[model samples]
Target: MQDRDDAITPGWVADLAEIGELVSGAYGHYVERMEMLPGPMRTDYAVPLAAGQIEVLRADGRIAGLLVLVPEPEHMLLDNVAVAPWAQGRGFGRRLMDHAEARARAAGYDRITLYTHVTMVENIEIYLRRGYVETHRAEVNGLHRVYMAKRLG
Candidate 1:
């Protein structure tokens, strides 16, 4: 487990990029397993926001993972989340979700939302375990995508 109170710094960009690549590869695998197009992950979307992104670092100062929040009027959307391949089974994703929920509660937001491909059953299960429920499902880019929401009180 990682300490949540540590300050996030800008130097974690390279680690974040590596994590993004891992995520993209994982997503591509999921898509292929479901017979969908293996579209490229939008790494560019992550670049400009590097300074404002949140990261979790190990005790030795290695970046463990990152979660990007896109603030909105009604709620905070989990725009992106990635954990390094080496750190995948260590509950880092859950930790990031916990941190995001806390931030949403502190900001007085009523809900948190995110979207993931329907074929990504593992990811969907993780969200469900964390109290998110599917709010909608739609076909996008030839794949079924699910939108989920969790109330933050």
Candidate 2:
């Protein structure tokens, strides 16, 4: 996995457009499916980019996806993850999640937490299959979300 902190460069500012495109392309279709913009679709990645929390995945020398991981006192938060629409079905999303869990473990974290919109049942199922358990459900920021966590062994 690329060290997000070490990977930042002056070029990152220029790459924002490509990063935004990947994120939007990944989540844009959900806007209609969910009847509102999905959280990722509305996000401005500059915040996370500036915080050194955004990790990029590349394929064929092109940005194929991104992952945002935030370390909390108690757990590492897998804040956001997305693969470009054209890049889906290539296992990039799974690889990114694995990187998040590995990073959490390397960072001395025993647990990792994440949430998805309640309307994204597929994501919830994928998390479940990967050993994440539903911790709770709540409405946050005008979105009904389902939170989940996994214990690192």
Candidate 3:
């Protein structure tokens, strides 16, 4: 796993498409439940990639997962985390999440924040297992979002 904090470069550009595909594949199943494309599916990876807020997790030298983490003044925002559909059962999501917390710790942050669609129960459950507490819920951009936070010791 590597976290890229430099301005967008050729390598980052090349990873954009793959990141999009990974996010789409991971969240596409919720289209029926949500009656529209999920937020992650509609995201343009370039914005975060250019801002150096994206990180990629590779398995066997191929992109298996990606994380979008933004450092806030008080907390690290784990904006997104997606595991390739094919890699779902292999613990890549957990690894990426572990990486997120590690990054936050390395950056001197004591907390990490994230949100997921309300309908994404599996994701909420996973976050709960990782010691994240529900902060609140709100409708943002037409999506019901469940916000969560983890205090990093």
User: Top model by lDDT, which number?
Assistant: 3
**What tens digits encode model 1's per-residue C-alpha lDDT throughout 5-84?**
34433334455565556557445666557775533364464563564655444423555666777678999888666666
* TM-scores of the candidates in the order shown: 0.76, 0.90, 0.91
Q: Can you tell me which runs of candidate 1 are displaced by over 4 Å?
A: 1-16, 25-28, 34-40, 46-61
lDDT by residue (1-153, candidate 3, tens digit) is 344432122227778888888888889999999998898888888998899998887765567788899999999999998888887788778888888999999999999999999999999999999999999999988999999999999
What lDDT would each prediction earn against the true structure? 0.68, 0.84, 0.85
lDDT of 2 by residue, 71-112 (tens): 899999999988888878988888888888999999999999
Q: Model 2 residue 8 lDDT?
A: 20
> What TM-score, to 2 decimals, does candidate 1 have?
0.76
Question: Candidate 2 — which residues are off by over 4 angstroms?
Answer: 1-11
- Residue pairs clashing in model 3 are none
Please say which candidate is ahead in lDDT: 2 or 3. 3
Error of 2 at 43 (Å): 1.4
